[model samples]
Each structure stands twice: as C-alpha cells, then as structure tokens.
Target: MAAQTETVQWKLGEQLYQNPLSGEHDVSDFIMEGQAAISFPQRRMRMENVLDPKLGQQANFVFWCPVEFPDSIAISWDFWPIREPGLCMTFFSAKGANGEDLFDPSLAERTGIYPQYHHSDIHAYHVSYFRRKEADERSFHTCNLRKSYGLHLVAQGGDPIPSVQDAAGPYRIQLLKWKDEIVFKINDMIVFQWHDDGTAYGKRLEGGKIGFRQLAPMIGEYANLSIHALERG
Candidate 1:
C-alpha cells in the first residue's frame, strides 16, 4: 500500500469562514524589520508597508502561515499588484535551524530583516517575482530562486508581470515542488525550474511553513491560496 495524500486550501476571498488577514491566521505570526499592514479590501487580502517611506530598505516585513506542510506539494495563489516601488517574495519549506516548530517561542524571535531569514534561525527556499522595486530591476526584470540559511541563488528567469501603471490583473501564480525539484510559473507560463543538488545548500528542506514577504512602500493583493499533495513517482 502507498501513503495516502491529501490537499489543503484557503480560499482567501471575502466569503471565507475564517479571517484570512486576522490574528487567527497568524497575521502577526512573525517578527518585522519595520511596520506593515494587512487588510481585506475588495474581498482580497492586501499587504502594504505603512511606515514612513523614508525608512526605505528598513521597511520590509514577512507574514507566516500558522500551519506546517508536507515536503512534496503544489502551492498556488492569485496575486494582484496594486502599488509598486517594492518587492514580493514567498518562502517555502521553512523550518527552524534546530528542527523546532517555526512558531516555537523558544526559537529566537524573527524581526523580518533579511539576515534573520537567510543567515540566522531558519532554513528555506525563497522565490522573488515581479521584481519592479529598484531601477535596475525595472530595466531588466527577472524572477530569482534562492535557498536560504545562507542566501544561495539557485536559479533565475525572466519576470512577466507588468508594472502597476499598465497592470490589470489577478495573475495566477503557481509554485510546484516535489522532493528536490521545484518549478515556478505565472499565468501558466513557466518562469524557472531547478533540481536541488541536496548536499550543497545544506540538507534538503522538508515539511515546513510558507510565508509572504514584502518590501516597504508597495501594496499587493492575494487570494485563493491552495496547497495540494503530490504523489511520488
């Protein structure tokens, strides 16, 4: 007999029984480098930097999910870029350095700074898309995949999301990971794919949490977050 797998989903629209942007969902679940806000506007979960724009690089934050997921699964969500001048990143397969629960109070607190996630307490794979935050990024857009606990850029590809001014969308974004292979796509168009070498970037990450991070002065909306178990070959 084979192990049975199940799929979990969060229909983040306004009709959800539970508040997607509330404390129950671990909205304030992680530490922050600066102030950010979460709200349900127009039936979608919206995230934005609320601190003074002067904070600049200091105004970034990450919101983590309350539950941990299995290693092999497909994660998909809808994204809408409302305001720019910021970046968006998704962290998956994240766990404490000591294999402790991510929400374990005993673990060192996370303050949303870049180093804390990429060099300190946790290990995970992060993918950044819609890279319109900086001047160089705007001139040549691309999506990047990195393994963390020491920020290693594993892969990269062209970014297809347009700038805010001309954007009209609820773009469908999908991240499919199974064992050591990961693939990212936007609107069904493949952006990047990579097979983890396993030993090089520390041990392969498995069974952990996922998180949404944003740089200051940018606002983004999200909905229909879903996770599905993938059968092994």
Candidate 2:
C-alpha cells in the first residue's frame, strides 16, 4: 500500500498543537502561544520567538512545523542575536515516504548538537530551505549574516562564502521557486539560484516533514518560538 501524505495549514492567531515528536522537552518552553502573525505587504506569515534566559539548561529552544510539499516550499524570517559569537540557527527535517529517518548522521555532522565552547557574546541571523528528492534523500541549503563574524552562504557543492570582515545586522531571508528554478535571497539581494533538474538528492529517499532549527553549542538566550506551515500551489 502507498503511504498517505498529510497537508497541514495554520492561520493568524491559530495555535499548533505541540506534537510528542517535539522531542523530550516541554512545549511551553519552546513555542509562545498566539505569537504567529501575517504580514500583509509581504503576503507571507511571520513566525517570531523571543528568548528568555531562565528556561531549560541552555538558552535556546526548538520547535517543529509540519508541511507537505507538492511543487515547492519557501520560508522567510528575521533573526537577531543578543550576543555576538555563537551559532544562531540550524535547520532539520525528517525524510522518507512515511516521514522516516534516513539522513541520520553523527552529532558532530548534524549542526544542532551542542558544542563544548563557551561564549556569552555571540549572535547570528540565518535563513534556509531544503528540497526533497525521495523517501531517503534531500538537499540542504542556507544563507546567513553574522554580527562580529562574516556572513556565510553556500549551496550544494559550492564553496562557503569567504568570511566577511564587518558586522551585519537584522537581515531578512527569502526562499522561493520561479517555475523550476530555486532561489535564495538575503535582505532582497539574490545570492544563489539553481535549476530544478531533479538532482537535489543524490541517492537517498524524499518527501516528509520539514522543520526549523537553531545551531547548538549556543550560550546566552535564543528562541525558535513561533513556527507555521502551509501548502504551496
């Protein structure tokens, strides 16, 4: 029997029930109730999270957004870090026909696992997206600007952006598809594009739940407080 695909939708002021797969943490610590809103001029919803220093062992939070992609997916958000020298965001997903785990790598390779470094003054702003290929395969991509650190943006098989020498502040990221082409932008500046020739995943599976993440080893306070999903036409 073929697996069934589920489509989930959320509107302004609607609350997404925190799923048990939300890991072993309390839902109240990660997501803020009624914090998601829509931006009229941009025609897109905005998800925001403000970090509180007194929650959990670390000062960062994680949440999951359930989505079904028919043709493509696009995500945009604004991030600002209170400090200046730590990883700000790391995105993750579950890839498979029935949302099974396939690309499970060691904690070192996966960006979310906390590192053993300590810095109280680090901060970052990031945006990213992924293209599903099969049940066990997917392609990952991201663009980010850091304060007190150079901004880095890289596509699959491309070199990392040379470290910038100045601090960048409050950048917006947009990911969208124009026909069969995928594009990535930072503060409205187009930085990367690729043709959808169906080569996103080399040989793994595809099609499953997508999510947002913050890179671990983060000190100080950070939050992925609000998240939502919708199907694209």
Show where candidate 2 strays beyond 4 Å.
1-62, 90-94, 97-169, 177-180, 200-207, 217-233
Estimate, for each residue in 1-233, the C-alpha lDDT of model 1 and write its tens digit. 01112322222222211223433253445444446787876667788987675776567888777677887777888899999888899999988988888877777767667887898888899999888888999889899999988899988988899999988888989887778778787998888887776787788888898888997778998887777775554
Q: Counting only residues 3 or more apart in sequence or on different chains, how many pairs clash (N, Cα, C under 3 Å) in candidate 2? A: 19
Which candidate leads the pack in TM-score? 1
What is the per-residue lDDT of model 2 for residues 61-108, given as tens digits with 9 covering 90 to 100? Answer: 333344433323454554333332223343322343233342323211
* Whole-model lDDT, model 1: 0.77
Deviating ranges (above 4 Å) for candidate 1: 1-34
